[model samples]
Every structure is written in C-alpha cells, then in structure tokens.
Target: MLLCFALSRCAVSPTGDKLYITNLYEDKLLTLARDGTLLATFKDPALDGPYGLYVTPAGQVLVCERLSFSKLQMDSEDRSKLATLATRERDGVRYPMSVCYSSTTTSIIVGQWVNDNILVFRVE
Candidate 1:
C-alpha cells in the first residue's frame, strides 16, 4: 500500500529487510515491508515530534523526540515502549533530531539540532 506522510525520516532495518519511518507531523512511527506494504503504526504520547529512527542489531527501535528532547526505545515486534532512554535535563540531550546505533561500539549517537553538538552514549 502507498501511504502519504507530511514530514518523515526513515531508517532501514538492521537486517535490511524492512523500513522504519518517523512520521514527524503525525507523531507516529511507520513500519513498512520491503515491498512497501504498510505493516504497522506506532503511536504514544511520548512520541512528540518523532524526528529520527534507528534500528539496533537486537531489533530495538530508537526514536528521537525533537519537541521533547528525549530518546525512546521500543520493541520492534510489538512497538511497546521499552524505556525512555534519555531526557533533556537528566541526560543533557538537547533538541535531539537524529539517532543511530553502533553495534560495533555498543553505543547510540545523537545529533542535537539546536545545540549543534553530537552526543554519544554507551549502551548499558
């Protein structure tokens, strides 16, 4: 199925078989099969202005909440919140607009849009 999104950022699955998209204007994450069929939509109050998406080797989804300056993790299978990984003041992450997981280094790298800095957190 073909879906239309106003503003979206996408990340390829770790296995390279699917796509995960952050529907920024809609506050949701969309999962699409390789063939472009809509698989699922993930939505939550915490997903405010979700701007970035990254899939981990363990099949975890990392989301960057631009408006909230928070990072969230969810199970790729069920789209259930695994944790609120980081918050603005608590973690010193500001205006996080993009995210990527590094399996080799076991860390998550965040691009702070407003702060103009990149932060790396070790996965623990």
Candidate 2:
C-alpha cells in the first residue's frame, strides 16, 4: 500500500476560496484552491509535527507544532515559509493540538493535547 498523506487538520481561508491543511507526520502544509487544485506546499524548517491550523483575516496561516510547541507563521506572499512567533509564553505550550484566532481580543488561542490548557497570544 502506498501512503498518500498525513493530513491532520484543515481550515478554510477568510474569503472561503482556499483551504489550508496541516500534515502531522509529513511536517508540511498544503494549500488547495476551491476547485481542488493544489496551490502551494509549505515545508518550513520549524514545522515539527504540525497538528493545528488557523488562518487570519489578512490571509495568514498559523501553524501549531505538537513537538516544538511553537506557533509558526505562513504569510500570503511566501507560501513555503514559516516564522516562529515570539509573543507566545513558550513555557507550557506543549503539544499544541488546535488553534483559533479571536478577533474580539485580537489574540491567537491555542489548545494543548495533553495538559488540556489553553494559551492565548496577542498579536502585536
């Protein structure tokens, strides 16, 4: 049997024309168009077991790594780039399971897999 992909999470873009998917085992992110065409593939160096995905209104994809416990940014311009965020506490962000952007607080909320605690980071 041939292994296809290790897709773990997916989130639709703000405009609802694109879909962002996270591959946990492969350590990559895939962006697909509305018509199911592969737009881009992001293989960031910091993508250590990425498990969660969140897309901002300005067309930014936030990736949550399970092992690194860090939030990496994937901007619209560069599809194959991941920049680690520094605003997060980084202390107890272990096993980041999921991510969601809260517009009310202008922050990114991340939920862990093991500890069951949520970490909130305000993007400045």
TM-score of each: 0.83, 0.82
Error of 1 at 43 (Å): 0.6
- Model 1 is weakest, by summed lDDT over 10 consecutive residues, at 67-76
Query: Which segments of candidate 2 are over 4 A away from where they belong?
Result: 1-5, 68-77, 80-82, 86-89
The clash numbers for all candidates, in the given order, read 0, 0
Give the per-residue lDDT of model 2 (tens digit) for 1-124. 1145688889988899888888888888878889978887777666788788888887777788865444444535566544566323555567778788888899988887788678877876
Candidate lDDT values, in order = 0.75, 0.73
lDDT of 2 at 101: 84
Local lDDT at 118 for model 1: 88
Query: Would you list the clashing residue pairs of candidate 2?
Result: none
Model 1 misplaced stretches (Cα beyond 4 Å): 1-5, 67-77
Scanning candidate 2 in windows of ten residues, the lowest lDDT window is: 67-76
